[model samples]
Target: MGTTLHPLNPSDANLIQARLSELGYYRYQPEGIWGLVSRSALQDFKAANGLSADDVWDGSVEASLRQARPTPASDTPFGEWSVVGFACSAEMNPRKMVVSAKGIVVGSMICDMQGPLARSSADWSGSVLCHIDGRDIASKISLRVSGQRLVDRSVIGTSTIVPTSFDRCS
Candidate 1:
């Protein structure tokens, strides 16, 4: 049988983003999506490497990136979190995480990550208090994640004694 090749999946976004960010080109947190920032970073990489500024990522782009180095600011440690990493289940903006919980965690488990965007954890004894993206969480006390639209009725940064169901991905 011949060797099989696979297409880029959602999980692959962070890996590529990590590499690019390490190279000092990608300037945003590696969420599992190829957005404008990622494209811009790729373009910058191409330009700096004397490659044509086109959308198509051929063999040469991959080759150049593989030979590149990473930056020091890729990540900082998540103190006392001796658990598996996680990703935001939100389809659009997937936040990276290093979380410990009382029960099951939805979404893919990412490795060596800690999101300053949000902190989801079980704050009390047998109580799962989930924290999602901190981008707008500070202003909003709760969320209404409905029908995969968004994780709903999520209360963060408060002593809201609740269960894991309140969290979309925990």
Candidate 2:
């Protein structure tokens, strides 16, 4: 198993810890690191989320974090932007999956993660329903651009990654 816990930034750790806490796995200060508190928190999170009792980060584990409902931002942009690329790394593991999409900013991008079959979790995927400037993007299927690879675009700040299949809409 290539699972290793990396030191998380204070803010990132706080966010992760907070998320875990919200899911009823409280056990950390949200300082964001592999300290005793975080480790315990991870253990709790794993058990609650139906993951291995071991404190390791796998796709399913990370998905639980990512699937947490996000606080609605003041400005949400939900529409066809076009799936360009997607990249993700398991929280405990350093490896990442980069998915590239066609350069078309469609309505929404949905992703269904086919996690390792060994893990006992549904292959999770859904569309990001963004609310931008009071407009609803609703849902749209995402298209794979150039396979799983990084793209020149940035997936941070004001971007929502929804996991939907790549199917054209009317």
Candidate 3:
């Protein structure tokens, strides 16, 4: 979007990386450096869109990218998600989740299930039957993919518990 032109500086490179990532060609987080990863992503985008693979960023690429639509989180093949959440001081280790392109959600490495994807004006989510304190309650859960290292989960499972994020699992 900037008029800085090709041979983009770090700031422009960062912007390009962010855009490319949104288009699903870049995997790593935007670091504001025009490195190999950035160039590769750009090249891939060009090839996909039938642009000349000159290994350079220019107005044509920018224009096409600007017109491109972002892929939904539900469509992306998510990574191996794990969390050691604490339930009443007991560490709930091995709690995991993974979403595939076929709409299958594998979780805790023990759960192989898929729930209907529900969309609202606020966000995208699906319901998973959670067994909390002995009752299986259908709970709302959202999974968001970002960069390379993280896929965030926001659980609006029950009114009794606050929406929980399990992103800091080590």
Candidate 4:
């Protein structure tokens, strides 16, 4: 018997669809299905990227997708910032954080991480697993600092959750 090929999962399919859409390869809603529309889009992407037109979600396709969507970097968030105040129900003091990029330090500020820093897509929204004081914590932090406005949500210490927005300090 020969090995069988399985269809992409809904989540993976959605991711591919979204990336394709962003790259102008797909023009349909991301319904998380590897149907004809998705296959055609994938083929187009492969042809455009000079890859084999297999119309399959292979390693090469995934790599191309990743290359198209890079993570947001610290340099993208560099600049003097005005804190918009944080809202939390628990007691916790603000701590300092340093943003850096490509081994160069960018900026530092007094802010609560509430969790460890993580890099998501250029869109800057996702969930990350953090470990604090030997304890594992899962938090959802949305950071969109590439633009003039920066927004963040995180949990500090044990129970303090803070949502903060910052604007460029002129």
Candidate 5:
């Protein structure tokens, strides 16, 4: 992997970095790369965990990842604290997407859903999801939101996708 160390998923790196910082490793930056600071922290963690101190996640790493995760499955609510990513695609053809949305923020509490849901509002409420690709098509939807600027991805499930986020505006 060159000098560029990697995490299982890009999202995990942020978690790992955050965890390291919490453990008092002052230099750990949440930049999503297993660099020197990360490596040093990993080494220290390995030693503490009674592993080889090789600075690799190996079996111990896997176990640590599992234990470090906040939940068994990702079911966190979409708080106003994060950004949202929404997209729709056909199951039969993953490449053929009908709708896509990115960088949408949750509506503030003061705004009404209808005001945001309506197409004419200049505010971020309705403007976020206004560019939906295919409104009428029944497709496999892939929706995700990041609570801390993609540091933690909150995968949106079918039950969570509201008819309109506008309702959530207020």
Candidate 6:
């Protein structure tokens, strides 16, 4: 079987919203709703990228969006983050993650779903997937890296993990 995408799902919408927000298209929080705002942003993005401004999130549109992500500066999520949080079945806690531009030096094992940061945004956000037993599990992980803080949210299976926020450690 192939991967199926449900555009209406909040998790899926969150991913789309994060990508759009990173690309300078969407301006509001990624609340995961297919409203006029989201449609307008998608249309604007399509028009700018030489695609028909239909506001439809299909395979073609997704492919285009994936290609439009900004490259990361380095292959790691390092430097001092102002805020950081982690959530799992057993425990949820606020923690400090120490990583570098090269890769993860300390803290939870995390990396960008995309390789590097080719583009930057004011309120940039991205998605991360959890790998268990060498398989990509069906979990929703989102990260928002802003001026001095980073917010991480992980939803596993059908359980919602409360979002964890972190600030860049000075």
- lDDT of each structure? 0.39, 0.37, 0.50, 0.49, 0.35, 0.52
lDDT of 5 by residue, 1-170 (tens): 32232465567677777776654432446877666656656654543333454566665564653454422111211222212333222133322221111222222212111111111112112222221332322222223322222222112322334433211110
Which digits, one per residue and each the tens of the lDDT, describe model 4 over residues 104-163? 111221232332233454333333445555565654545566455666554433554566
What RMSD value applies to candidate 2? 15.5
- TM for every model, in the order presented, reads 0.36, 0.33, 0.39, 0.36, 0.32, 0.38
Please say which candidate is ahead in TM-score: 2 or 5.
2
User: Which residue pairs clash within candidate 1?
Assistant: 22-70, 22-71, 117-134, 120-131, 143-153, 144-152, 144-153, 145-150, 145-151, 145-152
What's the best-to-worst order under lDDT?
A: 6, 3, 4, 1, 2, 5
lDDT of 1 by residue, 10-117 (tens): 576677678777765666678878777676566545544546544446676676666634212212111111112334443533342222211212234222112112
How many angstroms is residue 84 displaced in model 2 relative to the true structure, after the best TM-score fit? 56
The candidate 4 region of ten consecutive residues with least summed lDDT is: 100-109
Report the C-alpha lDDT of model 2 over 1-170, residue by residue, as the tens digit: 23232335566567767776555344334565556656555654554344554566666666656664531111111112222232222232212222211112322322322231121122222233434455645443232322222122223225544443321110
Cα deviation of 136, candidate 4, in Å: 66
Q: Extract clashing residue pairs from model 5.
A: 113-166, 116-126
Better of 3 and 6 by lDDT: 6
lDDT of 3 by residue, 1-170 (tens): 44344435777778888887776666678878887767766655664455654466667777777774633222332333454343322344444444432232333322212443443432345555655455555655565434333344545344633333433221
Pairs clashing within candidate 3: 96-108
Q: After aligning candidate 6 to the native by TM-score, how far in Å is the CA of 49 from where it should be?
A: 0.8
Better of 3 and 5 by TM-score: 3
Predicted candidate 6 versus true structure: per-residue lDDT over 52-128, tens digit per residue: 64667777778777883533212113344434343222232225554322222124444433322222443332343
Error of 1 at 150 (Å): 42
Clashes of each: 10, 27, 1, 1, 2, 19
- At residue 8, candidate 1 shows an lDDT of 45
